[model samples]
Target: MRGGPAFEVLFNINTYLKKKGLRDKFELTFFAPMEKPGQKMGDKALLMMDKMFKSMDIHKQVGSKIVAFESDGIVFENGRKILSDLTMFISAGTGHTILSSSDLPLSEAGFVVTNEYNEVEGFEGIYAIGDSASLMGAKWRAKQGHVAEVMAKNVAYGIAMHIQNIDSKRSYMGQLNILCMMDTGNGAAFVYRSEKGGKMIPLPIIGHWMKKAWGVYCKYSKLGKIPRIPGM
Candidate 1:
Protein backbone atom coordinates (compact mmCIF):
# COMPACT_ATOMS: atom_id res chain seq x y z
CA MET A 1 0.00 0.00 0.00
CA ARG A 2 1.56 3.29 -1.07
CA GLY A 3 -0.65 6.10 0.16
CA GLY A 4 -4.11 7.60 -0.21
CA PRO A 5 -7.14 5.57 1.03
CA ALA A 6 -5.42 2.25 0.44
CA PHE A 7 -3.03 3.01 3.28
CA GLU A 8 -5.94 2.85 5.70
CA VAL A 9 -6.96 -0.53 4.33
CA LEU A 10 -3.45 -1.82 4.96
CA PHE A 11 -3.60 -0.43 8.45
CA ASN A 12 -6.87 -2.28 8.99
CA ILE A 13 -5.26 -5.53 7.88
CA ASN A 14 -2.37 -4.89 10.23
CA THR A 15 -4.79 -4.38 13.07
CA TYR A 16 -6.56 -7.65 12.26
CA LEU A 17 -3.34 -9.65 12.04
CA LYS A 18 -2.10 -8.31 15.34
CA LYS A 19 -5.41 -9.01 17.05
CA LYS A 20 -5.44 -12.58 15.73
CA GLY A 21 -1.83 -13.17 16.86
CA LEU A 22 -0.77 -13.85 13.26
CA ARG A 23 1.29 -10.72 12.68
CA ASP A 24 4.62 -12.39 13.48
CA LYS A 25 3.78 -15.40 11.29
CA PHE A 26 3.79 -13.31 8.12
CA GLU A 27 6.04 -10.42 7.18
CA LEU A 28 4.27 -7.21 6.15
CA THR A 29 6.12 -4.66 4.09
CA PHE A 30 4.82 -1.50 2.41
CA PHE A 31 6.71 -0.19 -0.60
CA ALA A 32 6.30 3.04 -2.51
CA PRO A 33 8.28 5.00 -5.09
CA MET A 34 7.65 8.25 -3.29
CA GLU A 35 9.96 9.31 -0.46
CA LYS A 36 7.19 10.48 1.88
CA PRO A 37 4.13 8.33 1.34
CA GLY A 38 0.89 9.32 3.14
CA GLN A 39 2.10 12.93 3.35
CA LYS A 40 -1.05 13.93 1.53
CA MET A 41 -3.06 13.21 4.70
CA GLY A 42 -1.07 15.99 6.44
CA ASP A 43 1.61 15.98 9.17
CA LYS A 44 -0.49 14.69 12.03
CA ALA A 45 -1.77 11.66 10.11
CA LEU A 46 1.76 10.93 8.89
CA LEU A 47 3.06 11.06 12.48
CA MET A 48 0.28 8.70 13.60
CA MET A 49 1.10 6.26 10.82
CA ASP A 50 4.77 6.37 11.77
CA LYS A 51 3.92 5.51 15.35
CA MET A 52 1.65 2.66 14.24
CA PHE A 53 4.30 1.27 11.90
CA LYS A 54 6.94 1.33 14.60
CA SER A 55 4.63 -0.29 17.15
CA MET A 56 3.61 -3.03 14.74
CA ASP A 57 7.15 -3.65 13.47
CA ILE A 58 6.03 -3.17 9.85
CA HIS A 59 8.77 -2.68 7.26
CA LYS A 60 8.51 0.20 4.80
CA GLN A 61 10.45 0.64 1.56
CA VAL A 62 10.27 4.10 0.00
CA GLY A 63 12.00 6.13 -2.71
CA SER A 64 12.85 3.03 -4.74
CA LYS A 65 11.01 1.98 -7.88
CA ILE A 66 10.42 -1.72 -8.55
CA VAL A 67 12.24 -2.74 -11.72
CA ALA A 68 11.02 -6.33 -11.89
CA PHE A 69 9.27 -9.10 -10.02
CA GLU A 70 10.86 -12.52 -9.78
CA SER A 71 9.27 -15.81 -8.83
CA ASP A 72 10.48 -15.46 -5.27
CA GLY A 73 11.21 -11.78 -4.92
CA ILE A 74 11.11 -8.22 -6.34
CA VAL A 75 14.04 -6.35 -7.86
CA PHE A 76 14.34 -2.65 -7.13
CA GLU A 77 15.79 -0.09 -9.52
CA ASN A 78 18.74 0.37 -7.13
CA GLY A 79 19.64 -3.33 -7.54
CA ARG A 80 18.15 -4.31 -4.22
CA LYS A 81 16.03 -7.45 -3.99
CA ILE A 82 13.34 -8.25 -1.42
CA LEU A 83 12.54 -11.94 -1.18
CA SER A 84 9.03 -12.94 -0.15
CA ASP A 85 6.78 -15.97 -0.35
CA LEU A 86 3.98 -13.76 -1.65
CA THR A 87 3.67 -10.24 -2.95
CA MET A 88 0.74 -7.82 -3.25
CA PHE A 89 1.41 -4.72 -5.29
CA ILE A 90 -0.96 -1.81 -5.82
CA SER A 91 -0.52 0.22 -8.98
CA ALA A 92 -1.27 3.90 -9.48
CA GLY A 93 -4.21 4.93 -11.66
CA THR A 94 -3.78 5.38 -15.40
CA GLY A 95 -6.43 6.37 -17.90
CA HIS A 96 -7.81 3.80 -20.31
CA THR A 97 -5.81 3.40 -23.53
CA ILE A 98 -8.91 4.20 -25.61
CA LEU A 99 -8.73 7.80 -24.42
CA SER A 100 -5.35 8.15 -26.12
CA SER A 101 -7.00 7.55 -29.53
CA SER A 102 -9.97 9.80 -28.87
CA ASP A 103 -10.35 13.53 -29.57
CA LEU A 104 -10.68 14.41 -25.87
CA PRO A 105 -7.91 16.57 -24.39
CA LEU A 106 -5.95 14.31 -22.05
CA SER A 107 -3.35 14.65 -19.37
CA GLU A 108 0.07 13.00 -19.63
CA ALA A 109 -1.50 10.15 -17.63
CA GLY A 110 -4.24 9.94 -20.31
CA PHE A 111 -7.06 11.23 -18.06
CA VAL A 112 -9.54 13.45 -19.88
CA VAL A 113 -8.98 17.12 -19.00
CA THR A 114 -11.95 18.89 -17.39
CA ASN A 115 -12.82 22.10 -15.60
CA GLU A 116 -14.09 22.52 -12.02
CA TYR A 117 -17.61 21.67 -13.19
CA ASN A 118 -16.46 18.44 -14.87
CA GLU A 119 -17.03 20.05 -18.30
CA VAL A 120 -14.56 19.16 -21.02
CA GLU A 121 -12.49 22.19 -21.97
CA GLY A 122 -13.22 22.10 -25.73
CA PHE A 123 -16.19 19.74 -25.92
CA GLU A 124 -19.46 21.59 -25.66
CA GLY A 125 -22.20 19.92 -23.56
CA ILE A 126 -19.88 16.98 -22.95
CA TYR A 127 -18.70 16.28 -19.42
CA ALA A 128 -16.39 13.66 -18.01
CA ILE A 129 -16.72 12.43 -14.45
CA GLY A 130 -15.20 9.87 -12.09
CA ASP A 131 -11.79 8.33 -12.69
CA SER A 132 -12.17 9.09 -16.39
CA ALA A 133 -11.82 12.83 -15.77
CA SER A 134 -8.68 14.48 -14.41
CA LEU A 135 -9.19 16.17 -11.09
CA MET A 136 -7.96 19.73 -10.40
CA GLY A 137 -7.56 20.81 -6.80
CA ALA A 138 -5.10 20.36 -3.94
CA LYS A 139 -2.08 18.17 -4.68
CA TRP A 140 -3.64 15.54 -2.40
CA ARG A 141 -6.86 15.35 -4.41
CA ALA A 142 -7.84 11.83 -5.41
CA LYS A 143 -10.54 10.13 -7.50
CA GLN A 144 -13.22 8.57 -5.27
CA GLY A 145 -16.70 7.12 -5.57
CA HIS A 146 -18.34 9.89 -3.53
CA VAL A 147 -16.60 12.51 -5.66
CA ALA A 148 -17.85 10.77 -8.78
CA GLU A 149 -21.42 10.78 -7.49
CA VAL A 150 -21.15 14.51 -6.78
CA MET A 151 -19.84 15.11 -10.28
CA ALA A 152 -22.74 13.15 -11.78
CA LYS A 153 -25.22 15.26 -9.84
CA ASN A 154 -23.45 18.46 -10.89
CA VAL A 155 -23.46 17.42 -14.53
CA ALA A 156 -27.18 16.72 -14.40
CA TYR A 157 -27.75 20.14 -12.89
CA GLY A 158 -25.51 21.73 -15.51
CA ILE A 159 -27.55 20.12 -18.28
CA ALA A 160 -30.82 21.37 -16.81
CA MET A 161 -29.44 24.90 -16.40
CA HIS A 162 -28.22 24.88 -20.02
CA ILE A 163 -31.69 23.98 -21.27
CA GLN A 164 -33.18 26.77 -19.13
CA ASN A 165 -30.49 29.29 -20.10
CA ILE A 166 -29.48 29.73 -16.44
CA ASP A 167 -26.06 31.14 -15.57
CA SER A 168 -25.74 29.29 -12.23
CA LYS A 169 -23.67 26.12 -12.12
CA ARG A 170 -22.52 23.68 -9.48
CA SER A 171 -18.92 22.71 -8.75
CA TYR A 172 -17.50 19.51 -7.25
CA MET A 173 -14.51 21.30 -5.75
CA GLY A 174 -16.34 22.66 -2.70
CA GLN A 175 -17.46 19.12 -1.75
CA LEU A 176 -14.01 17.51 -1.92
CA ASN A 177 -13.09 15.65 1.24
CA ILE A 178 -11.74 12.26 2.35
CA LEU A 179 -14.39 10.37 4.27
CA CYS A 180 -13.98 6.63 4.65
CA MET A 181 -14.74 3.85 7.08
CA MET A 182 -11.64 1.71 7.38
CA ASP A 183 -12.60 -1.74 8.61
CA THR A 184 -10.62 -4.53 10.14
CA GLY A 185 -12.14 -8.01 10.42
CA ASN A 186 -13.22 -7.36 14.00
CA GLY A 187 -13.43 -3.56 14.18
CA ALA A 188 -13.19 -0.34 12.19
CA ALA A 189 -12.07 3.26 12.17
CA PHE A 190 -13.72 6.44 10.97
CA VAL A 191 -11.28 8.43 8.87
CA TYR A 192 -12.01 11.98 7.83
CA ARG A 193 -9.82 14.60 6.21
CA SER A 194 -10.59 17.99 4.72
CA GLU A 195 -9.10 21.50 4.41
CA LYS A 196 -9.24 21.74 8.20
CA GLY A 197 -7.25 18.60 9.08
CA GLY A 198 -7.44 14.82 9.37
CA LYS A 199 -8.82 12.57 12.11
CA MET A 200 -9.04 8.81 12.68
CA ILE A 201 -11.60 7.57 15.18
CA PRO A 202 -11.25 3.99 16.30
CA LEU A 203 -14.53 2.13 16.56
CA PRO A 204 -13.88 -1.17 18.23
CA ILE A 205 -16.80 -3.35 17.06
CA ILE A 206 -19.84 -1.43 15.84
CA GLY A 207 -17.84 0.31 13.14
CA HIS A 208 -17.43 -2.98 11.26
CA TRP A 209 -21.19 -3.50 11.24
CA MET A 210 -21.70 0.08 10.09
CA LYS A 211 -19.53 -0.56 7.03
CA LYS A 212 -21.45 -3.75 6.24
CA ALA A 213 -24.72 -1.89 6.49
CA TRP A 214 -23.47 0.82 4.17
CA GLY A 215 -22.47 -1.79 1.61
CA VAL A 216 -25.95 -3.34 1.72
CA TYR A 217 -27.59 0.04 1.41
CA CYS A 218 -25.46 0.92 -1.59
CA LYS A 219 -26.27 -2.30 -3.39
CA TYR A 220 -30.00 -2.17 -2.82
CA SER A 221 -30.26 1.53 -3.58
CA LYS A 222 -28.45 1.09 -6.87
CA LEU A 223 -30.80 -1.73 -7.95
CA GLY A 224 -33.80 0.55 -7.31
CA LYS A 225 -35.24 -1.87 -4.77
CA ILE A 226 -34.74 0.62 -1.94
CA PRO A 227 -34.91 4.38 -2.00
CA ARG A 228 -31.58 6.07 -1.50
CA ILE A 229 -31.30 8.19 1.58
CA PRO A 230 -30.67 11.80 0.62
CA GLY A 231 -26.94 12.68 0.41
CA MET A 232 -25.93 9.10 1.35
Candidate 2:
Protein backbone atom coordinates (compact mmCIF):
# COMPACT_ATOMS: atom_id res chain seq x y z
CA MET A 1 0.00 0.00 0.00
CA ARG A 2 3.03 2.22 0.25
CA GLY A 3 2.74 3.79 -3.20
CA GLY A 4 2.10 0.43 -4.82
CA PRO A 5 1.22 1.08 -8.48
CA ALA A 6 -0.19 -2.38 -9.16
CA PHE A 7 -2.75 -2.07 -6.39
CA GLU A 8 -3.92 1.26 -7.73
CA VAL A 9 -4.30 -0.15 -11.25
CA LEU A 10 -6.29 -3.09 -9.89
CA PHE A 11 -8.59 -0.74 -8.01
CA ASN A 12 -9.32 1.18 -11.20
CA ILE A 13 -9.95 -2.05 -13.09
CA ASN A 14 -12.39 -3.17 -10.41
CA THR A 15 -14.23 0.13 -10.69
CA TYR A 16 -14.43 -0.18 -14.47
CA LEU A 17 -15.83 -3.70 -14.20
CA LYS A 18 -18.44 -2.71 -11.62
CA LYS A 19 -19.52 0.24 -13.72
CA LYS A 20 -19.96 -2.07 -16.69
CA GLY A 21 -22.04 -4.55 -14.63
CA LEU A 22 -19.66 -7.39 -15.49
CA ARG A 23 -18.38 -8.29 -12.04
CA ASP A 24 -19.83 -11.80 -11.78
CA LYS A 25 -17.71 -13.42 -14.48
CA PHE A 26 -14.40 -11.98 -13.36
CA GLU A 27 -12.30 -13.31 -10.48
CA LEU A 28 -9.78 -10.88 -9.00
CA THR A 29 -6.51 -12.64 -8.23
CA PHE A 30 -4.21 -10.72 -5.91
CA PHE A 31 -0.63 -11.85 -5.48
CA ALA A 32 0.42 -10.18 -2.27
CA PRO A 33 1.93 -11.15 1.09
CA MET A 34 -0.79 -10.52 3.67
CA GLU A 35 -4.48 -11.26 3.99
CA LYS A 36 -5.52 -7.74 4.92
CA PRO A 37 -3.71 -5.90 2.17
CA GLY A 38 -2.72 -2.27 2.66
CA GLN A 39 -3.96 0.27 0.13
CA LYS A 40 -2.34 3.63 -0.47
CA MET A 41 -5.68 5.37 -0.20
CA GLY A 42 -6.39 6.76 3.30
CA ASP A 43 -8.30 5.14 6.15
CA LYS A 44 -11.73 5.45 4.55
CA ALA A 45 -10.50 4.10 1.24
CA LEU A 46 -8.56 1.48 3.12
CA LEU A 47 -11.78 0.41 4.87
CA MET A 48 -13.52 0.07 1.52
CA MET A 49 -10.58 -1.94 0.22
CA ASP A 50 -10.91 -4.26 3.20
CA LYS A 51 -14.65 -4.56 2.69
CA MET A 52 -14.17 -5.38 -0.98
CA PHE A 53 -11.45 -7.97 -0.30
CA LYS A 54 -13.44 -9.51 2.54
CA SER A 55 -16.30 -10.04 0.13
CA MET A 56 -14.03 -12.00 -2.18
CA ASP A 57 -12.60 -15.55 -1.95
CA ILE A 58 -8.90 -14.95 -2.45
CA HIS A 59 -5.97 -17.37 -2.81
CA LYS A 60 -2.73 -16.07 -1.31
CA GLN A 61 0.65 -16.97 -2.79
CA VAL A 62 3.11 -15.66 -0.21
CA GLY A 63 6.39 -15.40 -2.08
CA SER A 64 8.83 -12.55 -2.77
CA LYS A 65 10.85 -11.97 -5.97
CA ILE A 66 14.41 -12.22 -4.75
CA VAL A 67 16.98 -10.72 -7.14
CA ALA A 68 20.04 -12.91 -7.05
CA PHE A 69 23.02 -11.96 -9.27
CA GLU A 70 23.11 -8.61 -11.13
CA SER A 71 24.43 -10.09 -14.37
CA ASP A 72 21.57 -12.56 -14.68
CA GLY A 73 17.88 -12.22 -13.80
CA ILE A 74 16.67 -13.43 -10.40
CA VAL A 75 14.39 -16.23 -9.19
CA PHE A 76 11.24 -16.17 -7.13
CA GLU A 77 10.81 -17.61 -3.64
CA ASN A 78 8.45 -20.19 -5.22
CA GLY A 79 11.44 -21.75 -7.00
CA ARG A 80 10.35 -20.43 -10.40
CA LYS A 81 13.18 -19.04 -12.52
CA ILE A 82 12.45 -16.23 -14.97
CA LEU A 83 14.87 -15.21 -17.69
CA SER A 84 15.14 -11.58 -18.78
CA ASP A 85 13.03 -10.40 -21.69
CA LEU A 86 14.76 -7.11 -22.41
CA THR A 87 15.43 -5.90 -18.87
CA MET A 88 14.37 -2.30 -18.54
CA PHE A 89 14.10 -0.32 -15.34
CA ILE A 90 11.76 2.63 -15.41
CA SER A 91 12.94 5.28 -12.99
CA ALA A 92 9.99 6.48 -10.93
CA GLY A 93 11.96 8.23 -8.14
CA THR A 94 14.80 9.45 -10.31
CA GLY A 95 12.55 12.03 -11.95
CA HIS A 96 11.99 13.55 -8.51
CA THR A 97 15.71 13.50 -7.90
CA ILE A 98 16.32 15.41 -11.14
CA LEU A 99 13.84 18.08 -10.10
CA SER A 100 15.27 18.30 -6.57
CA SER A 101 18.84 18.69 -7.83
CA SER A 102 17.95 21.80 -9.79
CA ASP A 103 18.58 25.32 -8.44
CA LEU A 104 15.54 25.05 -6.20
CA PRO A 105 14.84 24.41 -2.55
CA LEU A 106 14.12 20.72 -1.97
CA SER A 107 12.75 18.71 0.89
CA GLU A 108 14.75 16.02 2.70
CA ALA A 109 12.90 13.41 0.65
CA GLY A 110 14.36 14.98 -2.51
CA PHE A 111 11.20 16.70 -3.72
CA VAL A 112 10.77 20.33 -4.72
CA VAL A 113 9.91 22.44 -1.64
CA THR A 114 6.74 24.43 -2.13
CA ASN A 115 4.50 26.52 0.08
CA GLU A 116 0.83 25.90 0.75
CA TYR A 117 0.09 28.14 -2.23
CA ASN A 118 2.17 25.82 -4.49
CA GLU A 119 4.91 28.43 -4.68
CA VAL A 120 8.56 27.42 -4.54
CA GLU A 121 10.36 29.26 -1.75
CA GLY A 122 13.04 31.21 -3.65
CA PHE A 123 11.72 30.89 -7.20
CA GLU A 124 9.14 33.50 -8.13
CA GLY A 125 6.74 32.69 -10.97
CA ILE A 126 7.56 29.03 -10.39
CA TYR A 127 5.19 26.57 -8.74
CA ALA A 128 5.28 22.86 -7.93
CA ILE A 129 2.54 20.29 -7.56
CA GLY A 130 1.75 16.59 -8.00
CA ASP A 131 4.37 13.94 -7.29
CA SER A 132 7.12 16.45 -8.04
CA ALA A 133 6.22 18.44 -4.92
CA SER A 134 6.21 17.23 -1.34
CA LEU A 135 2.93 17.62 0.49
CA MET A 136 3.83 19.41 3.73
CA GLY A 137 1.19 18.15 6.16
CA ALA A 138 -0.59 14.97 7.17
CA LYS A 139 1.49 11.82 7.04
CA TRP A 140 -1.29 10.04 5.15
CA ARG A 141 -1.39 12.64 2.38
CA ALA A 142 -1.74 11.06 -1.08
CA LYS A 143 -1.00 12.20 -4.59
CA GLN A 144 -4.46 12.31 -6.11
CA GLY A 145 -6.33 13.95 -8.98
CA HIS A 146 -8.56 16.15 -6.78
CA VAL A 147 -5.55 17.34 -4.81
CA ALA A 148 -3.77 18.21 -8.05
CA GLU A 149 -6.88 20.03 -9.28
CA VAL A 150 -7.03 22.01 -6.03
CA MET A 151 -3.37 22.91 -6.34
CA ALA A 152 -3.86 23.96 -9.97
CA LYS A 153 -6.76 26.20 -9.01
CA ASN A 154 -4.72 27.58 -6.15
CA VAL A 155 -1.83 28.33 -8.47
CA ALA A 156 -4.13 30.22 -10.80
CA TYR A 157 -5.61 32.19 -7.90
CA GLY A 158 -2.18 32.84 -6.41
CA ILE A 159 -1.01 34.25 -9.72
CA ALA A 160 -4.10 36.46 -9.90
CA MET A 161 -3.65 37.59 -6.29
CA HIS A 162 -0.05 38.56 -7.05
CA ILE A 163 -1.00 40.48 -10.17
CA GLN A 164 -4.27 42.11 -8.96
CA ASN A 165 -3.09 42.67 -5.37
CA ILE A 166 -6.02 40.72 -3.91
CA ASP A 167 -6.22 39.95 -0.19
CA SER A 168 -7.38 36.34 -0.63
CA LYS A 169 -4.56 33.78 -0.75
CA ARG A 170 -4.99 30.11 -1.56
CA SER A 171 -3.44 27.45 0.65
CA TYR A 172 -3.76 23.64 0.31
CA MET A 173 -2.10 22.82 3.67
CA GLY A 174 -5.29 22.44 5.66
CA GLN A 175 -7.30 20.94 2.78
CA LEU A 176 -5.47 17.61 2.66
CA ASN A 177 -8.10 14.89 2.29
CA ILE A 178 -8.63 11.32 1.01
CA LEU A 179 -11.90 11.64 -0.86
CA CYS A 180 -12.15 8.70 -3.28
CA MET A 181 -14.74 6.44 -4.88
CA MET A 182 -13.82 2.76 -4.67
CA ASP A 183 -15.69 0.36 -6.91
CA THR A 184 -16.13 -3.31 -6.19
CA GLY A 185 -17.31 -5.91 -8.71
CA ASN A 186 -20.96 -4.95 -8.30
CA GLY A 187 -20.95 -1.60 -6.47
CA ALA A 188 -18.86 1.25 -5.15
CA ALA A 189 -18.03 2.82 -1.81
CA PHE A 190 -17.66 6.54 -1.31
CA VAL A 191 -14.67 7.35 0.84
CA TYR A 192 -13.88 10.66 2.52
CA ARG A 193 -11.13 11.72 4.89
CA SER A 194 -10.07 14.92 6.59
CA GLU A 195 -8.21 16.26 9.59
CA LYS A 196 -11.44 15.80 11.55
CA GLY A 197 -12.17 12.19 10.58
CA GLY A 198 -12.92 9.70 7.80
CA LYS A 199 -15.94 7.75 6.48
CA MET A 200 -16.86 5.07 3.96
CA ILE A 201 -20.28 5.21 2.27
CA PRO A 202 -21.14 1.97 0.54
CA LEU A 203 -23.32 2.04 -2.56
CA PRO A 204 -24.96 -0.80 -4.43
CA ILE A 205 -26.91 -1.42 -7.67
CA ILE A 206 -27.51 2.13 -8.90
CA GLY A 207 -24.07 3.15 -7.71
CA HIS A 208 -22.63 1.51 -10.81
CA TRP A 209 -24.63 3.83 -13.07
CA MET A 210 -23.51 6.84 -11.09
CA LYS A 211 -19.87 6.00 -11.80
CA LYS A 212 -20.59 5.46 -15.50
CA ALA A 213 -22.35 8.83 -15.57
CA TRP A 214 -19.31 10.35 -13.92
CA GLY A 215 -17.00 8.93 -16.58
CA VAL A 216 -19.25 10.26 -19.35
CA TYR A 217 -19.39 13.62 -17.67
CA CYS A 218 -15.60 13.68 -17.34
CA LYS A 219 -15.09 12.91 -21.01
CA TYR A 220 -17.69 15.34 -22.32
CA SER A 221 -16.59 18.09 -19.96
CA LYS A 222 -12.96 17.70 -20.98
CA LEU A 223 -14.02 17.97 -24.63
CA GLY A 224 -16.02 21.13 -23.76
CA LYS A 225 -19.20 19.53 -25.10
CA ILE A 226 -20.81 19.69 -21.65
CA PRO A 227 -20.51 21.99 -18.69
CA ARG A 228 -18.74 20.75 -15.57
CA ILE A 229 -20.87 20.79 -12.46
CA PRO A 230 -19.60 22.68 -9.45
CA GLY A 231 -17.21 20.64 -7.16
CA MET A 232 -17.28 17.73 -9.71
For all candidates, the clash counts are 0, 0
Off by over 4 Å in 2: 1-48, 60-101, 108-110
Candidate 1 on 58-144: residue-level lDDT in tens? 888878888898999888888888888877777877889888889999998899999999999778988999989998888767677
Top model number, lDDT: 1
**C-alpha lDDT of all candidate models, in order:** 0.81, 0.65
Q: Name the best candidate (by TM-score).
A: 1
Q: Report the C-alpha displacement of residue 44, candidate 2, in angstroms.
A: 6.3
Give the range where candidate 1 is weakest over 10 consecutive residues by summed lDDT.
1-10
Taking all chains together, each candidate's TM-score versus the true structure is: 0.88, 0.69
Error of model 2, residue 195, in angstroms: 1.5
| Candidate 2: clashing residue pairs, number | 0
lDDT per residue for candidate 2 within 111-221, as digits (tens), equals 788989889977879999877787788755676777888898899888888899877778987778877665543566666767776677878766656777888999999
